[model samples]
Target: MPADGIIAHLRTLTHDEHVEVAGVGQGRRVFRVDGVEIDVIHRDLGRHHVGQCGSCALRDRCVEGFWALRVDHAGGVQPCLLRDDLRLGVSRLLGDPAGLASAVAEHVAAFTEGTL
Candidate 1:
């Protein structure tokens, strides 16, 4: 399939399809996509001393719980989004780096456009 086609398929999946709001480390919604670990904040609340991804305006915040994942957008410049962590056991199912790159790009496009 074309890269965009794969992106379209991912866009159709709703929050209920792969995520559930949970209370963990100052409250977060955990997203489980069979492998990757992504914790999203359902509420606009902040985690004291824990740092906020959306609020921090610094470059190289890896030490602050931010990891770099390149995202290629079909439209605008790719935005940087923070992920919680990765599950080692399911990493194999997530696929290789090249495939993951495309997936991440598509994910960014779909997410920023509100298509997913």
Candidate 2:
């Protein structure tokens, strides 16, 4: 999709109590969803890092270590949003922003009911 379309869709998805668009730029966006900050990286811009390394589970290991498989987005990994089951739901929407919005809404709703 076009950049504008993506941005618009993102804004719509995040327009809720559980999610909000924190920032935006070319090929990138940041979201604050359900107390977790999510950075959506769409393309490689030659940058080797993103988000906070301090909170990463694999922080003790080298950058080329085993965690690389899970943390590596197109370019680099950012601090992941949520954890465990919630993270799984969000992770499934990495490439599809529209689906992400729907999933997030569902997740948030489920979370409120203590079911997520």
Q: TM-score, each model?
A: 0.24, 0.26
Candidate 1 minimal-lDDT segment of 10 residues? 84-93
**Sliding window of 10 residues with minimal summed lDDT for model 2:** 62-71
Predicted candidate 2 versus true structure: per-residue lDDT over 1-116, tens digit per residue: 33456556666767532322222211345565666765454433212322333344644442221112224443322223323333432565679989866766664445434354
Tens digits of lDDT, candidate 1, 62-85: 332322333333222223333322
lDDT of each: 0.38, 0.41
Q: Which stretches of candidate 2 lie over 4 Å from their true place?
A: 1-85
